[model samples]
Target: MTRWDAVRVRQGLVDSCCSAEQAGDQALRRGRPREARRHYERMLAEAIRLAEQFPDLSTRRDLTLAFNKYGAFWVGAHRLDQAAEAYAEGLAVATRLREENPDDIRLLRDLRFGEFTLGEIARQTGGPAGRRTAHDHCTTALALAEHLVGTDPHHTGDRRELGVVQERLGLLATERQELDEAAEWYARALSVRRELAAELPGDPRARRDLGVQYERLGDLALRRRDLEAARAHYDESLSLRRSLLGDDPRDLSTQRDLSVVCERLGDVALLTDGPEQARQWYDDSFAILDAAFGPKHPDTRTLRKKLRGHPVTPN
Candidate 1:
């Protein structure tokens, strides 16, 4: 093609990408998944066309960004497989660009997020090899995020990302029955989130994460048969979650987790003290679960059955 023709194609591709991105943003803001997906797909196509027309470092970076945005959209839609594939493609492009321009911090951060997403996918799928890969990817992402934070301590985004990565790592460890390691990682993540919450008092995400970490720590303690520690963590988690989420439906998970912990604590009391104390604790747990999940919910039914001398599935 002639130089003018090539320039026109590149400009057209850029315009299409810009327009598609605006549409995608608007669709996402309006909570229209299908519309957002269409716009992002169009942007991805235009980005590929631009890369072909001008196969330069800058065009490659743009393509990477497009893929990253597409991946993010997929993630929001809960399409883990598609998100992983998009992130993988973006990572490859970003790695190549990073080799040419090593100082491009944004590319580096994108690569880290891609790796983190890949790790999350592997963890969700589950398997020994997948778990190992997830752990490795999380470790690398955490290190990268930590480095970013060290370079600029006020980089709240990086710090938040690091805390999330740590929390995921802790969860993976917990799944593998590595209670000690899980507790340690969860504590570290919780510390970072607490600091973040203090700095950005209005941000609910940080507070929510800290509450989740406390819940995880409580689970780990319970698994280790440390009733006192478990109770403390559970109480803290429940208090924090209640303060933040109140009685909103969004707090169901936290409510369920607290109920489980309460039930477990009752079991411990039964083994340690007398039946009366255990019954009181069990009743408290049952009341909470019944109120939040209703009498016919699995948890409430199981608890009721247990009280009636039937086999109950451990929470």
Candidate 2:
């Protein structure tokens, strides 16, 4: 084919596959899963074709990313088997690339994150047997997280990722009722996140990570029946989350997090304060969900159900 023909083919690939991917993203943000899936299916088909046709670094990288996102979508849709298959395929591609470029930062991050995501899927997979798989994935991810951070300790993103990895391990520990182990992991995560937040006070993501660490610690405190500690941690998270949305209360992501803080505070309120205060907090949380995602949304409906009862439970 001539140069012009080759250029035309490349443009066709962009218009066909990239455009589909973009449309999928937009549909996902709008909560149109069926529409998103249609677009993603097309994008995946094209991505596979592209990778098979040109097994170069860039095409292979795109293929890896395609599988990564497709797997994530399956996870959200509650298709565990498909999610695992897609993630495993992505990891295989990524592993080949990492072997080729041993010290490459991008590949290192990809492998680390891929492991972490796989751990999540494994944890949610076939009940008891999934636990061991989940733990192994998380352990490998944590090691990669440490290695990535060690490669560039000054890199803020890598440091933050280390904290996230620690937090994921902590979550698994909590589910296993290993409170002490969970606490240790959470403490480490909090330390790293706190330092990042303090160093980059202006960065919204840094503050948000610190806030999430506090939220998780607060959850642990609640599990231990340390009401006062839970309240204090929740308060700190609320403050930080509020700070992140100072002028943009409409920011759905921050608002959703803030809603969690509110619901947790509501739980504490049921114990410390009266039911009135607790109801108010729950209302605040539900209102955010109702407005952002509509009342018919799963989350909104769940919260609405909770609001129907006495609201004494700690859901």
Candidate 3:
């Protein structure tokens, strides 16, 4: 193709990528995973075609953005392997762009996000190499986030991203049973999330992460037989999740978790009280489970059997 024709074709590809990304995002938000996948795949293919059709456009910021967006879609779809590949491509492009234009702050930020995502994927699928890779990438991303927070405290997105990285770090520490370290990380993340919530109460991601951190702490407390601590943390988690999710059927995961916590607390009550009070707690626990899982669910059936076997009497 002639030079002018090539430019037009590249622009067409860019437009196609943008359209695909928009469609993919909509599909994701609507919980249409299959449709989202199709859009993201199409965007990736178009990006590759553009790269081959016009080498000059391959490293352009727009093209890099397409890769990043596609990677985000893949991540949302739980296609972590594909997400990593897309992020790798985007990172390479961003690196080249940054080298050529050292003053491009946006490109630098994108590179950091790419690295953060890579770390997330690695952390989710653990082996020795995966753990090592996750640690390195998360450490690098953390340093970058810290720098951003220090230099630009008003940048809410940077602070939020820092909170996310800290939460992930907490998860890693928790997995290793480093309770103190995990608590420290989670506390920092919670602080950032609280700040973000104060500024933008409508944004729920930070709040959700905070709930998750609380639940993790509750699990640890339970393992140590710290019943009071576990109860407190689980209560906090349930309250937050209830506020954020309400009675939405899609939030059954959180609902089930809350029910489990209630059942555990009921067990504690059984040990401390006579049959009447114990039975009350057990009834409440069963009610929560039935509401969360429905009566026909396997969990409900199992809990029902347990309740029947225990046969709490009215004192």
Top candidate when judged by lDDT against the true structure: 2
Off by over 4 Å in 1: 1-11, 18-40, 54-59, 72-80, 246-315
Candidates 1 and 2 compared: the better one by TM-score is 2
**Per-candidate TM vs. native?**
0.75, 0.84, 0.73
Stronger candidate by lDDT (1 vs 2): 2
Question: What pairs collide in candidate 1?
Answer: none
> Per-residue lDDT for 155-223 in model 2, tens only?
998899899989988988898899999999999999999999989988999999999999999999999
Cα lDDT of all candidates, in order?
Answer: 0.82, 0.88, 0.77
TM-score of 2: 0.84
Task: Please provide, for model 1 over 1-315, each residue's C-alpha lDDT reduced to its tens digit, 9 standing for 90 to 100.
Answer: 999998888888899999999999999999898999999999999999889878898788899889989988988888878988998899899888878888778877877887888898878768898899899889888887887788789988889998999989999998898877888899899899889988987776777777777777877887888878877887777677666656465677767766775676677677566676777777878888898889989889988888776233334
Candidate 1 structure, TM-score to reference: 0.75
Please, what are the lDDT tens digits per residue for candidate 3 over residues 123-213? 8888768877887888888987887788789998899889888988877777777878878887888788878877876767666766776
**How many clashing pairs does model 1 include?**
0
List residue ranges in candidate 3 displaced over 4 A: 1-7, 19-39, 51-59, 68-79, 201-203, 245-315
User: Could you give the C-alpha RMSD of every candidate to the true structure, in order shown?
Assistant: 4.8, 3.6, 4.7
TM-score of 3: 0.73
| Backbone N/Cα/C clashes per model | 0, 0, 0
Indicate the worst ten consecutive residues by lDDT in candidate 1.
306-315
